[model samples]
Target: MSSPRQQHWENVYSTRQADEVSWFQDDPTLSLDLIARSGISANAPIIDIGGGASVLIDRLLDAGHSALTVLDISHVGLTVAQKRLGDHAGRVTWIAQDVTAWHPPQDAFALWHDRAVFHFLVEAADRAAYVRALDRGLRPGGFVILAPFSLTGPERCSGLLVRRYSAAMLQAELGADYALVNQQPQTHLTPAGNRQDFIWCLFRKSAT
Candidate 1:
C-alpha cells in the first residue's frame, strides 16, 4: 500500500481544482490578516511550505510582497499553480521537494506559512524532522504561521488520520525556540458543509 499521507493528499487534489479544495477560499482573508498584523517588513522574504495548489501565491503577490517562494512535494500541484498565475508566476520562486529533506539557503526567509500540513506528521520522528526544517529555513526573528487541526477538531482529513493539537500542546511540540505570539480558533467548512475547528498559531523566532 502507498504511504497514507501521500495517497491521501494526492487523491484529494486529484479530484479537485484548486478552488475545490476544502481549504480553498476566494481570498484567504484570515491569512492575509495575520501577515499584516505580524509587523514584519513589507519586503520581507515569505515562503509558503506545502503550498501546492492553493490560492496563497495569488494573494501574496497582490499584496506587493515580492520575495515569495512556494514549496511542495507535488509536481502536478505546482504545475497547476504555475498555469493559474501565467506570466506573473515567473516572479515567484518554486521548489518541488519534501520539506524535511530540502535544505533552504542560509537565513532564507523572514516568514513561513503552513496550512493543513503539520497535522499530517503523525509520527514523532516525522514531526521532529519538520521542526528541524523550520530551524534551517527561517531567518532570525522570522515569523511562522500555522493552521492545524485543534484538539477538539475532526480526527480525519482527506480520509487519513491527523495529529491534532491545542495551542499549548503545539507550542510544546515545536519547542522553546519559538514563542507563540498569537492564536485564534477557526472553523473551516468541508465539502460536505460540515465545520472543522482548527487552531491558527503565529510564532516568532526567539532571539537566543
Candidate 2:
C-alpha cells in the first residue's frame, strides 16, 4: 500500500519514458561543477535526494566517486536508473524512500545533492522534516547542493503545486547552521522544449 505521494511518482515513472520527463538532462553539468567545487574526496560519501532516474550517478561513478547513494520515493524510478547502470549499479546504493520520512544514518554523508525536488514540498512541515534528515545525515563539515524552482519558474510540475524560491528563501529554510557558499540561476530546457527556471545553491554545514 503506497502513500499518495509514492503512488503518484510510481505511476509517473512506470508510465513515462525517463528521457521524456521534464527534468531529464543529458548532462548534469551544473551539478557536477558544484560537487567538484566542494572538493570532497572520491571516497567521500555522497547522497542524492530524490535522484530518481537521473544519470547524475552514472557521471559520478565515471568520475571515480566510489561512495554514492541515490534516494527516491519511486521504486520504478530507481529500477530505471539501476537498469541503465547495469553491473555498475552494484557499486552504488539505491534507497527507495521519501526524503521527508527517511531516517538516514548519523553523520553518514559528506555531501548531499538535490535537484528539482525541494520545491515540491509546498508544506512547511514537510520541509522541516527534510531539514531534520539533512542535519542528522550529513557530517559536520558536509556540503549541500540544492536546486529548486526559481521565483520565475512554474508554479506547478507533474500536476502538483510547487513553491518557487530565491537564494535567501533557501538559506532561511536551512537556518543558521549552514553557510551559503554560492548560488546561480539556470534556465533548463525540458524534453518538450519548455524552459524552466531553477536556482542552485551550495551551502556548507557548521563544523562545530
Best by TM-score: 2
Q: State the TM-score for model 1.
A: 0.93
Encode model 1's per-residue lDDT on 153-179: one tens digit a residue: 889877678999888988998888899
Clashes of 2: 0
lDDT of 2: 0.97
> What digit string (tens of lDDT, one per residue) describes model 2 on residues 11-72?
99999999999999999999999999999999999999999999999999999999999999
Estimate every model's Cα lDDT from 0 to 1: 0.85, 0.97
- Model 2 misses residue 7 by how many Å? 0.4
TM-scores for every candidate against the unseen true structure: 0.93, 0.99
Lowest summed lDDT across 10 adjacent residues in model 1 is found at 1-10
